[model samples]
Target: MFGFGKKQDQPQSTIQSEFVEDVAPAAPQVTSVSSASTPSPLMSVSSITLPGAYLHPITKDNGIEYLFINENPMGVPAGKPKERMTGSFGPLPMRTNYDKLLYGTGAAYLTGFFGGGIYGAYRGLQIAQGNSFKIRYNSVLNSIGRHGPRISNSMGVLTMGWALLDNTIYSFRGVSDYYNHISAAFLAGAIFKSTAGVRPALIAGGLMTGVVGSYGLWEQFTSEKKETKIPSLAPAPAA
Candidate 1:
């Protein structure tokens, strides 16, 4: 009876040991699961979205934050969208308006006249080196008379042609000053062709278009960046 009681006690002890081992593993697992489910305080703080935060186009998804005119907190938000900004159809303001045609034509005529007179004097000097003063004076006068009108007329015609083309473009499409300037430059190539021929015309036209277009593009890019600059979190302290 004592031996039988000993065997029965052994079986009961084995069952208790197995039960303890299984129960001990389960408690650790429960603890680990609970800890994972509860997010850390640092993580919670980082996840909170601040006011005026926005995504940047070049940044990867969820990588960076930026402010725009609408999202800037430091200043009053824009009352209207940027797309609504449009130029006027009427004459430009007094401060901005200037007579390009008059200036251009006058400048051309003056340049031509002076240039012709200078060349004539040079040629006369060359031919009259061994002659009398009277003969030299006559030679100079004759050269000036011959070349002056030709040079002056040529420059005048070119300037007028360019001005006419520019005015026409402005009349039809005056909505954007930028476009007006670009179109004028392109058309002015024709006048260049009249003097310099086809290849030169193409080169001049390309240069003008490229320069104007690049300038416009640069202005646009800078303006957009300015509009989208990040605003300060709070107003600056008054001095």
Candidate 2:
């Protein structure tokens, strides 16, 4: 009985010692993995770089200077300055849709005024050839007053419609080029003249399309030429 008891006690002690040894090795493995996964602060700081044309700010025992791309900074590319898009229509530089609308309205009003004046003058000449001077003047003034508001209302509606269509196409289809502008103008004119007559619709559409398209083309061509004459100088790429 004493020999059997000693054999059981010896096996139990050996098993506990083996279990402790296995757990000890696992602790060190876990610690090694944690240390390897940790990132160094110095490495993170050294990896950052300046973006775009902005020069990296150098802080040392010396001084500091804010350097820009075309301002002749050291180690920067030297060339002509870049041409930024003005997003303008003639003399009006539109920064928002509201600006565009306001300008469009004004342009429409001016066109209406000129058109009415021309029509009134033609009618006045016809009246002068048949009636007395007093009648001609009255007739001319009446004709001007009548045609002015009519032409203005029509033109205003057409301009607003064009703006709406242009904005819609740009928002949904991302098509805001010259062709898009011309198409929008033509479509707007057609829609405006739909109730008038077939001939009127065709005439209005053709006129609007030609005017807007030619203007856009001219602007684009001029801008391209200017850009070509002045090369754009960009800074080094950011990391």
* Candidate achieving the largest lDDT: 2
Candidate 1 lDDT tens digits, 1-239: 11111122233311121122121212221111123254443433222221111112222223244454434544444564232222211242111122455555676788889998898888887777557889999989888877877888767766666556656765576433556656666667555664678788878677656755675676567743332111111222332
Tell me the whole-model lDDT of each prediction, alpha carbons only.
Answer: 0.50, 0.56
lDDT of 1 at 223: 49
Question: Per-residue alpha-carbon lDDT of model 2 for 148-228, expressed as tens digits?
Answer: 778878888888898887777666765446566788889888888888999899888998998787776665577443321
Task: Compute the lDDT of residue 176 as modeled in candidate 2.
Answer: 49
Q: List residue ranges in candidate 1 displaced over 4 A.
A: 1-98, 175-186, 189-197, 200-239
